[model samples]
Target: MSVHILIIDDEMNWIKTFSDILIDYQVCDAEDIFNATNLSDACEVLRNNAIDILFLDLNLGCESGQDAIQGLRAEFPNSTLVVMSGVTTGSIPLMCMERGAYDYLPKAMSTDELVLSIQKVISRVEHFDRVRFAPNDLSMVNTQLPFSSYVTQDEKLHSVFEYLKVVSMTQHPILITGESGVGKGVLAKAIAEYSRPNGPFVSLNVAGLDEQMFSDTLFGHTKGAYTNASSQRTGMIAKANGGTLFLDEIGDLSLSQQIKLLYFTQSGEYQRIGSDLIETSDAKIVFATNQNLIELIELGKFRKDLFYRLNTHHINIPPLRQRIGDIPLLIKKFVHQAAEDYAINVPHISDGLIELLKSYCYPGNVRELSSIVYNAVLKSDGQVLTFSDFEFPEIRDIESCSLNAEPETNDTSFKRLDDLFDEKIIDALRVSDGNQSKAASLLGVSQSTISRRLKKLQI
Candidate 1:
């Protein structure tokens, strides 16, 4: 794809030569090549042109290129950041990465190296552009939603969807992991829908089950096998024949339970309780966990063999706080759905309310967001929903407390901390002309930290 590229260097000759080569290669037109001499000039250029790639020289007179990485990243999040330097030795590249440079390039690059760098940057940016969420009336305008159950506008999640789509071609057992409430179960079902659309999708949460209960639930028990076994009962594996069997909370399984599961996952063979005859199901196995299985393995609580058997393909859902972009779409979808389900007139939502809600870090992820939205809908007594309609434990406690004490004194410290951090974030944003990266630089924090604080403060 033809792209706009900006080159920043103190040497005007280098910029001219580079622009000429890129234009000759048909990578971009003359009008698309923007050149700047330093970080200040580069920022000014960015304000006028949203380039697809930025080639920033490490040495710009007296300025180091590393100084621009974070600010540029914060301002033009979608632009590819490449740091070119004469000195790329020691931990310079690593330092650039920490500051958010996408790639590092040596100044003395051959034509082949230049071409390869351009190709690499182009390829990376193209993937991001393809999967990036475009705003629409409701959700985002993409190829299609991952599934009806998912309400998101996160590029990271979209990348995850792309990966799942590719892996669906194989029948390997899939492992899904995430923090609780990030919707591992929902992701598991989406994987099932994608991979085994024609077959059933069954799920079981095996967190608290014992050996007998686990075995009975997974493998059907024969009649008269136990005191309560008065009739034949089919197991989840049998019920999910020819489809996907999702085992949630796999990390909670005991070592012995892991053995049984490992055997079933390794070979489809299993036997009914009190019956010697072996039975097999054609179900595709899927496992999910919020816990760190690797950590559990280190502690000897989980079987390494079982973990290997289940981790043929892995998907980890990021937490809600990391993908705040989804907040608007999620709010819209949940508001309408809740109104429809409860048979209430839909309340008009405002950008203010959305902004307020977006600031909250949903520890419960999508499920928590849904609950908050549903509760607000139910509590509203007017056409428009407001902050009063929503009840947050942190907010309420924060409203009731004074910030004179330590945070550990009570849950009220959450709001206390917010009150303190929010002031600094807002001040920085104001001083920096509302650029999150500049604000972060002013406050000596990461850009994401500034962004999150602003969101938390609903600024």
Candidate 2:
């Protein structure tokens, strides 16, 4: 079905221009377009029609657009409202976002930029719809945690999901460890959604935050807390009251900040900066880090006490390279998503392309793979995506080496060496469930050797 877009702007010329742009870009059918010059008309259209997207001009001729944002949001909660204004001061956009606007775009944008903004909002709306109305199949259920958007067919991820379910119900602080771009934040959100569905999920990246910033951001400052502090600010913990406070990149917290966080974790109380009164928050803490906390603890970079408190429930997400079978599934999802975002036909993924992707060790994990697919789709001219479409440097290097390298002098010895090491490595990896360390131990080889062979053999 074509998406219905309602454009509310007092300027008839601007409305015509935006309408023409959307029509030319094929954002929606011409018949699906609706326009209103004022708040009353916009409300009437919203009440009568199921508008998929609403573009509201922040400055109506005589009406204050901000006044209508909350009302419209309350009336049409499903419609994705995008606020547009000529004001470039940035505060208006932030205010609009705080008032539940899906996005804010400068009214001076080119047609392409405007279309891109609309497309982004549409994609988000569609994603939320899919998540809300996902299949009720028993097989799709995690069976441990409540249903979430994090889908996986891999057994390792399924085990993680199960563990997340058990940990979600507890108030204990959780530590989720994984490589960067392995969806640590996504898992944290899933945990929050499962445990405190109705409460706010407040996230703060503690990396690069100094002691003062850390304390102020987490345990917000009261009025007159500092020279620049003119008003009171609620900290993440208080904002996440009765919900989950997700502290990402916790490994970067300094020793002093760690001590403060540990105190809060143990006592569930904190005082705002420059405040005499102490406040308490019932926010569940969830911490995630790509860094090795144990190593940091040993190095005296991370406090042992804080580590113990955070690891009351620990989960390690396996890297994408270890779950090769999920590569095709993730590619398929990303391809369809990219197609929808670009307003183009979904490109087909060939088996050769899938095999090529599966062979490479994705150091950046699932996020890197998604980027590869999206970039390929952007460059694709045909329906089918082949191996050449992917721009992975590692794969190209391995191929170049194989084709250009000189032949071995002892062909028989080379053949024997390849068969012996390759077969044993493959067998060991199978037994170890794609764990390189375990595979190396089983084969009595160093982990580095296993890694080198896996790359050399293009496995």
lDDT of each: 0.76, 0.77
Error (Å) of candidate 2 at residue 338 is: 1.0
Candidate number achieving the greatest lDDT relative to the actual structure: 2
Give TM-scores for every candidate, taking all chains together and pairing residue i with residue i.
0.59, 0.56
lDDT of 2: 0.77
Worst window of 10 by summed lDDT in candidate 1: 398-407
Q: How far in Å is the alpha carbon of 232 misplaced in model 1?
A: 1.5
- Which candidate has the highest TM-score of all? 1
The TM-score obtained by model 2 is 0.56
* Candidate 1 Cα RMSD (Å): 14.3
lDDT for 196 (candidate 2): 93
For candidate 2, the 10 contiguous residues with the lowest summed lDDT are 395-404
